[model samples]
Target chain A: MILINGQPENRIPVSDRGLQYGDGLFETLAFRNGELELLEQHIMRLQRGCKRINLSFQHVDSLRAELAMLCAQTAEDSVIKIILTRGSGGRGYKAPLENEAIRIISSHSMPEYPEANQSGVTVRLCEQRLGLNPTLAGLKHLNRLEQVLARSEWDDRTISEGLMLNINENLIEGTMSNLFIVKNQQLLTPALTQAGIAGIMRSKVMEIADSMSIACHEKALTVNDLLDADEVFLTNSIIKLWPVKTLLHNDTNTHWQHGALTQQIQNALKDLAH
Target chain B: MILINGQPENRIPVSDRGLQYGDGLFETLAFRNGELELLEQHIMRLQRGCKRINLSFQHVDSLRAELAMLCAQTAEDSVIKIILTRGSGGRGYKAPLENEAIRIISSHSMPEYPEANQSGVTVRLCEQRLGLNPTLAGLKHLNRLEQVLARSEWDDRTISEGLMLNINENLIEGTMSNLFIVKNQQLLTPALTQAGIAGIMRSKVMEIADSMSIACHEKALTVNDLLDADEVFLTNSIIKLWPVKTLLHNDTNTHWQHGALTQQIQNALKDLAH
Candidate 1:
């Protein structure tokens, strides 16, 4: 079901900034048993995006309530998406002085993924590079053409995700999820100060690591850093966590045994969601 | 009138990848006397964008024919806009294997611009720096949050436009148009190899300069270069050209007495549109 600003509709004005200029932010969270997971973090990120882009987000509290009402109607597992655009604007690029942001809230049944995805998944390195933009580095703004292009690079059912790196050859993230690797008993993820979205699941994993007294680090990781790691995994609000069993890069392959740390983090993440 | 895939409608599916991920390209051209100005150039740029993003543009001829028909319906002055999106896809970043691009064509009355704009206009330097992405550079794709943000930086009725620079501190272009400056009888515009759109009007300006025996150069320009120029101007498909009479940067100001070269080029461009 799709609700465009609390009204059931499947159409948005053609002049919407979301369509005109990709001027918007979006959140995709998992909803199960009448509860939305990590909704607070998502809302916080959305508000942060609005602040960064100079858009007003004063109605966030009321928006949360509307989302809750929508989730209350669903009893099974589902994925909920929220798209907040700068609304319709004039033909020029200048934003309207008096603006009403458009909020598109929708829900869909979760896709059935193979159990193999949980055990482990294979990933390929993408040729497309993430542009360096510190201003838009972490927020989940709607200018996601880079991600869409990276994800389009591979379609093998056996290859679950594509790993993307910034133009400087530093590891950034997966096309759809954040990445973390285990090296010398320390968890390391690429710093998103230049590009890539800082996923909510990534933050939760770090939080869980902190509570469990495990070491987690966010640094400028390189391809060699990833290849030398003992274990690798991906995270997103929807997928939760997926241990990467093999990574194919530069026509060569590297394999991992899926270390104990990945399992521990996975179990912790699952526990927190419930 | 607004037409989505040949049907009159002002709404598009909310699930459209254009609105969701900005996986699309758009063109805005002026229509007067039953003909689209620079229609061929617009189509070429759109086709080039499709190729750069791995999209198919085999239907270009048909799309052009439809646009011509739409333009014919308007005997008076109007503005025509064509939007081509990668159609709706599943909830992931991965594009659908079999793609069906969506085309939205629309027309509106010409906006009334002050007669002073034709003579010359003032501009301000925007604090929002455009992200450097060579992969997506020069293509008029839909991921325009940077432009939107830059344009939002100012709203003074006196300032006709805002100048934007790339991450490297090099003057890229105006928020809504390509930029050019006349220094020592030579026209210089920023090289779009790193960032900025290769606007159709920019190409026409260069063409006009060539036929008029004027030297036009595309280089990596700096603020110092702009400040030292004898004349400055901006170009886009819609506005054609607007001479920059004054530029405000770093609390200081640089003024130019709209040079004769600007008028010559502007007159040449106007003649070509006929």
Candidate 2:
């Protein structure tokens, strides 16, 4: 089902800035057993994105209500996507002074992954590099050609995800998830001060680590650091966590055991989900 | 009037990747006195952009026919915009194997600029900076949040445009146009190898300079380079060329005469338009 500005429609005007210049923000959420997971965190992130882009999105309560309404009708686990655009009709890049935000909420069946993926999945390094823009860092905006190009680098069904690095050669994130590495029993994730998205599931994992007294840090990470790590994992709202069993970099095939910390975090996340 | 894939419609599917991830490219063109200006140049640039992004735009002939049809019905000078998107229905960032391109062609009334703007216009330095990524540079793709943010920095009607620099503080281009500096009777425009859109008019200006035997080079430019220039101007498809009379930067204003070379190029462009 799709709701465009509270209406049952599947079409938007051709002039929408979201379509014209990708002037919008989006959130991918999980709905499990008729409940939206991480609803508040998703809303908080969306709100921050709107503020960063100066898009006036004034439908928070109504959007929440609509999500609840949609979830109640779904019988299976689903993925909900919400798109908020700086509404239509502007001369060019300069936005309309009096603007109303356009909200699109849609739901789709959750992707069915192989059962083995839960244990561990293979990941590859993408050739496409992300551009460094601090102003847009950490915001899940609609301008995502970099991710799309990176994701297009491979079509191997066995490789679950592709990781991307910024132009500076620092490992930043996966095409659809945040990356984390465990080294000497310490958790480290790339700081998104220059690029990459600050995913909701990534934040949740960090919080869970803090509660368990695990040392977690956000800093610049390199391929060398990732290759030397004790364990590695990827996270997103849909796929909560996927342990990296093997990494394909250039012609290399480094392997890991999916270690103790990854298992602990996975179990903690599952417990919270229930 | 508007046309979506040869149909006279103003709405597109909400699932369009153009809106979802900005997986698209667009071109802004000018139609004057029932004739399209630089039609081939615009189409060539769009084709190049489509190739770079791997979007199979297989409707060049039909697109030309539609633009000619749209221009035939217009009785006044107009601006035409064409947007080609990588159709719909993709899972996450990975594109669908079999895809069709979505084309949107629309016509708008020409913007009314002050007559004095032809003589010279004021420009300001934008605080927003563009990110550097060679993979996406020079292609007029749909990821334009950086330009949108830069244009939003000022609302002064008198300021004709804003100049943007990349993260490295290298002067790249104007918010809505390409920039060129004249020094020692030579022409210099910032190289778009690392960032900035390679505007169609920028290419035309370079060609015009070459025909006139004026030395022209594309190189990294700084604010000091701009201020030290003998003359400065901006170019785009809509506003053919506007000599920079005043440059507002960091609480100081630098002034310039329209310069003889600028007038000579303007006359040459006018002759070609006729």
Best candidate per lDDT, number?
2
Candidate topping TM-score? 2
Query: lDDT scores for all predictions?
Result: 0.88, 0.91
CAPRI category for model 2:
high
> Candidate 1 — which residues are off by over 4 angstroms?
none
Q: For all the predictions, what are the DockQ values?
A: 0.91, 0.91
Cα deviation of B53 in candidate 2 (Å)?
0.6
Candidate 1, residues A1-274: lDDT per residue as tens digits? 7888788889999999999999999999999655788888888888888888887878887788778777888778899999999999755788887676688998888977788899899999999999988888998989999999998887788899899999999999999999999988889999999899999999999999899888999999999999999999999988899999999987788998778999999999875453
lDDT of 2 by residue, A9-50 (tens): 899999899998999999999998667888899999988998
State how far residue B215 of model 1 sits from its true place (Å): 2.4
RMSD, every candidate, angstroms: 1.6, 1.2
